[model samples]
Target: MYYADAAADNSVTAYDLSSGSRTVLCNMHVQELTLYQEKLYFTCTDGEKRTIYRMNLDGSDLESLASCEDLWYMTIYKDVIYYVNYENDQYAILSMKLDGTESRILRKYNASDLCIAEDKIFFAERDTRYLYSMNLDGSDVQQLNSTYSRCINYMNGQLYYYGSEENGRNVYSCDLNGNVTGKYTSGAKFLMLMEEELYYYDWDDVLHILPLNKKSEEENTSHGTNIVSYKQEDVLKPVRSYLASNWAGYTLDEGNITKQGNTWIILLSESGGSRQYQLIIDLTTGKITILCTTEDILPVSVYLYDTAPSVSPSAAQLSEEELNSIADTWYEQNYGPGGAWCFEYHDYDGNGTYEAFAVCGPVMGDGYDIDPYNILEAILYISSTGEITVIEKDVRDTDFCVENEIEKEYYIEYDGKGYYVPHFRSGGILWQPMYGVKDNKPYDTGISGHISLDNDGDLLYTPNSGIFMCPECNNHVEHKHILAYDETSGELKSAVKYPSGEIVN
Candidate 1:
């Protein structure tokens, strides 16, 4: 079996279950080490990027899969790697091919404890008392039960998890239909799921295991997918020290800083998504300083099929001036002024055509200052054929874009289909899955507080944590209080948190 050994140099270790011999597969600070189809997929830092890498079990032909802003839990379902990609001010569950093609964001909210159960991916919901399930394409999400699972897995038609209650810790088992089957060991912390054994830890942190029935191809199973507070804890030291400077009286902690050759690039945020900025730091001088703003900043996937067609111009043909001119116009027209922007040319949609994706938004303010409503974050797409399409979003009507409900969507069917948008309507919350999601399921109140897709016709919604303003009052508000969800009811609970940890609704 393959697992991770992060005690020292951080390696992927393989252990012979029978012979009990150990072998080191790779030496990189790895997270979410997954073995699929004889290839091991894992994530590590390359100084400038948090990249996912793929290699053989025998440790040869190591290749890069994709580079994301951040990734926590990862699992392989049907040869595709579904991972939690952390963004500047938010987190999303994204899926891509094993080699990093066909990338899509499934959810804007947080995901936790990802695994597969009964042909669907199962995971534990953080800060909640339920286990959830979803399809591989990021649809059909539903709450399994009220069990406050700490870690979980599925095996032999049984959903197994280690959960904690007011009394103590307990291991529980249930069927695919959410019926309690039996109760396993108690007062134990579930570590992971094996083919026929359950690994656990006691109160003293001693590891132990108990045997169970075997499941076919158990290596494909993911256990205990968890998402932490999401700081760039693994960033290089120089980058961290630079960020520690607190540029512009703003805090740069919890942001991404990577070293690319002599240049240091940073994607930073103050409070997750409230104040996000991209900076290119130059280390050529004796002291580090700001070099430029606009280069590639948005995290994107690079696939084998991303090669351009014959009609596409050569790398030398597209001058930097020409590209920046196009990007500058788009940013000023669609987004706003006084912001940082970065663009990258790639087949981000995996449609075999290269597109220049321009990510631009305003600079964030320090905690004391409130932001203006003029700041609208926009991701514009300019295809090689000169076709421009903006990623559709259901955001507030910051500008004239919200003149009509239809226009409020702010998207065209041509391209950049942003799926699973949680629209908080006057009646209730409804999720708009425009395309690329499973259509078989229904949505309703029964599946409330969950991100699953169903056909119940209920208003499915998720918290919209964006630059929000009180439309009637026309005042800027704290981003944290802008979008807070009641973890139990799944309703748009009106609440806000101040910097002093005070709660107001």
Candidate 2:
């Protein structure tokens, strides 16, 4: 598991579950440690500026992406960076290309707890604290719920958030359209789901667990899985003995302990020295294993993938008909009949050869609504030798639309290469997939890219003047509001278009 240690030297560390080994990737004040495409993206300080940096998983190639004074809640959605920026005590959500170029504000609201899923951005307005969602372009904004909510998260087709109700704080569930589904575990916050169970911290900061499959929140589960806490003696006895025998000269200071399944991971440091060591203890058998001594094992540099797959410059090309046949044959051989399938081809990796985006599942009935059928979508990588492979599979139809809609591309420079990344439209929702080639195989990186589109289905970019005027309203009495940024505060402001076709703030 990869975690940021804010309290200890402000470092980012990775712990191996099986070996109980720890590797401190970087020793810097870090926040939002997101690992994408074998690279680690995090927010840290560059002097007084809050900056986002990208580095290898092993702490190499540390490059700064962007820096600002009032930036927080940095997250990557489909390779596009979404973050909250505050200026003049006003909050505005902005997005930027992964390379830190093409920065634009999507919307201006006092927002917090920003999350993105299913081609929509979810957030909580700071003043009302209500849940709201909007299209990737910041248009068609909709309120998801009225109750004050925070800690918003998207999971498994539902939005889970901490809702403040009249009675008490409860973890609530709602659909993407703002309809309430269920409420579970009252008086709890920081909701998280793992292994088909819900884990939360209560008012007293005590951790609790509830099985998701249980009929109600009242159902009970085994204490071993629910509240897995160990007594101090269970940890200190073995730790004290190991420390005294190994580092008798140093005095014990403090230790940070975390648990995973049946094992306990403890990091112990000295009082006045820089010595630090890790202890992995099996709670089941009470056997303690020393992971490393400060002087013993430092992390070795390792890349996420030793070799990334590249397209052959002279690869054989396929006609559209030939590509379809290959995808159909693979689908039949794997799924074995009954389901229908189709393919959309694009050069996802910016390679000369076009990769296939395949969608296969139970045939859909007329007129929308896919919840009735099991859908599976995949990205197919075909070699020059006509060998077919499924690079990424089981993508939900709701994500990358499976419909026959017009395709658009967002052109941006990445890794010094210009790519017209394909964006697909389904049911009026548009999304793009982030692709990575690892070990000579291509796969969806699970990072999505969002692009703003005008009503005419063209890519919408920030105007050169940083001001927007409604193109449709000309000499009309209806007042149309357009977005503009304040010159002094850099905050998003609204301008009204008048009947005379003149716009004024």
Candidate 3:
């Protein structure tokens, strides 16, 4: 198998699992890796410029395809190369033919984890840190879910990606429209699915394999509460020792240990029970990484609620004008002059120190949709000492829409509780992707399930446009028939009617 090692200077390497041998194909800063026909396509740093290169499997006939100042990721579909260009401090999703012809920009936004499947393009927008799907031509953009997702992989009619939640980064199975169906093992980075097994890297950068031939019912038993083998102890000892020495009062929570083949997922909490952390350990290397940390208790029931809790404003040391001045100065320094920006202060987590949402644009407007040509948004955290931490940037928030009253809710869960995260929106007219906050960092929490109808009573599904049902084979078809999405199967069916007017799925 051929893979790009992002940690190893993005070196493209080929591994022989059966023979336990390895060979380095390209020794450069290879960023993106994909295979088309018999050619290996990848992007690498090439002396004063980043360029895309293609070569044979044996590393022969190397040729440069495209060059730019900076490129993030790329994917190929139907003999075309789709990549993100971060030149001139702007992210432009562009596509070109195999011979590097017909190059054009598809969208002006920051994108990563780009993958094309089922004739649709899936990507993770860095600004909001959410998964989104769009047409192959980069139109009909739709947010799939709220999870901060990357390392997207598609298999068996389902899309799987690494979801960054309050708990940890785990692999989640969702439909094309982003309705989460099931969660697999935890703590994953790059995921590569094979015919009989799934190979992925753990948080420790160690490689692990999961059997794909296992039955669905056996999945839980395979990874849940199994007795710790002697091999598992070796992995835990290092993590336990690391925590005991480095974390002082923090101790490993043995009860939460989950076995995912060669990897182990463990939890730890402070002696005073004030903070808890989730970690994954590599069995072979005995390496460990803290996936997430929370105060008091884990947010177990956060997903049950939909509405955001209200926050009562408190007296602030900095006036509104002072906050605006700070935000304006930040905008000018980061994006330069001749740009319009706006700011709003709110204690999102009900903390005494208020954070500001600064939305900037190239046009002289105050709202998020000021310029269709440029995207600018930032969530700035203001500490009690007047320190600023830009938690998120390049986000297009809908809450700041000036034309319409858009009520979008963002949330963060802590200590078994959920708090609504704040964001601006422009009603139902513009993109209203939700955002979630955890550990003072904001992430995109994508929209799901809801379906809207057009003025002609035609059902409009966001993720899949061809999804539909028939009240009767050829009988009266109307928009009243609500479409029910099956996340597990990634199929859309009518909630009220069947394919032939029968009351069956």
Candidate 4:
């Protein structure tokens, strides 16, 4: 049997059950682990990237299986190691041979907690709130049932799982065909099977054991599982100075966790009155290093946020200037002024062959009515040669009028030839109506209400209000209280409102 020790150093320890001898199989500060074929597999951090590694049962001949910055967990079958790679906010299940060959992605899901049985794999998906199964190669992937389950154990052609229900925690038993038998136990927190008895750690930290026989009464099978005893004093240790320092009034944020070299770094923020400071902790040595301090003079809010530092590639790394130069040349020739030069390149094209989009503006001329302030115009350029073309003029409107009436209008001249115009829509007045609303509007509803809308142009605001919209449908919506209409169909398809001081659609 194989077990992972995630609580300490994230290592996998294997034992020879026949001889009662054990060895540390694989050790690393990885988040997930598993074993197969007298070999240990786990995830590890190499600088800023997370990757997978495999080693023999005796912890020798370690080798890398896959290189992904987000790989997690592992389950080995006959000759394959199946794992998950989370990147771009998506999770993909992948498998590779023992020698790191023939890698294939089994399936993709927003998932957590995974296990394998026979030729099938099981996973818990939070979005669907269901335990799903799929063939080892990704075919036949489907949700087994509507049951919310976790901590799956597959043995003897039976699947044992646990989950929380309305009343309390419950253990369930099912077969390979997704058929539920019955509840194994209720009100149990941590349940595991060893030998023939079910071992569990209770809510009170007391261990209990019960026989696996389904025929016995529930109360008759349970007994204490903890065989070792110790005095209360023996289990407690005096808190050291450095350990106690962690309890100081310091707040930790998500970006504070980072990996460097072979250690994890965590940044803690300490606040005092109107001042704030930051301390960095090295996980390997348990040492703290102060980074910076924000005094009362500097706005505390500006420096209060935590951000993970980017890891820079080695200076010897080759630069991609050649590729960039080629792309720039093509961009200027195909989209420059007097041509199609009104756009700027934003991203590579769908086929990954060329730039997808470019930024372009209009050309300008001298001040005149036809020239409308004679401002310079700009356009996006694209070609094999890098060159920019511009039309120069003045287009500023300091004293402006609206609809032949004296009204406030903001206009500015750019590059001694371009003009900027402003309008009012919602967010804020912009230079043009095509830019929609500005972003200076208040976002909260003073009455602390909720907003709802439907397709029939019906609107509802609520604290305890009922459904005010008949059958409302929204095509696109933004921060509550904003609405828009479809120009082509003349139909209202967007609306926003606040509910309970929160923005909702």
Give RMSD to native, each candidate: 24.3, 23.7, 18.3, 23.6
Q: Model 3, range 28-126, lDDT digits (tens) per residue?
A: 767668788999998888787899899999888888989998887688889989888888867778999998888998878778778789999888887
**Model 2 stretches with alpha carbons more than 4 Å out:** 165-167, 213-505
Worst 10 residues of 4 by lDDT: 221-230
Residue 481 in candidate 2, Cα distance off native in Å = 50
Query: TM-score rank, highest first?
Result: 3, 2, 1, 4
TM-score per candidate:
0.40, 0.44, 0.45, 0.39
lDDT of 4 at 231: 17
lDDT of 4 by residue, 235-279 (tens): 111111332444466554435556342123344455454434444
lDDT for residue 485 in candidate 3, whole number 0-100: 43
Tens-place lDDT per residue, model 1, 21-86, is 889988888877877788888889877678899998898999998886777677787777877766
Please report, as a residue range, the 10-residue window in candidate 1 with the lowest summed lDDT.
220-229
Instruction: Name the top lDDT candidate.
Output: 2
lDDT of the structure predicted as candidate 3: 0.59
Question: How many clashes (backbone N, Cα, C below 3 Å) per candidate?
Answer: 22, 3, 11, 59
Superior by lDDT: candidate 3 or candidate 4: 3
Instruction: Give the distance in Å from residue 135's predicted Cα in candidate 3 to where it truly belongs.
Output: 0.6
lDDT string for model 2 (1-505, tens) is 7889756766999888788798898989898888888888889877768888889888888889888777788888898999988766578899998888999989876988888999999999989898899998899888877877778877778888776644246677888988877655455677766676566766656455555655443232211221112346534654566557666765544456675534466676666677776655543223455545767563321111111113221233665566576667656654555233444554544556554545454445664343322355544554322335554455556544444333333333333222233445555554554444433235544434353434532223333234445654545557555433346753334455445756566
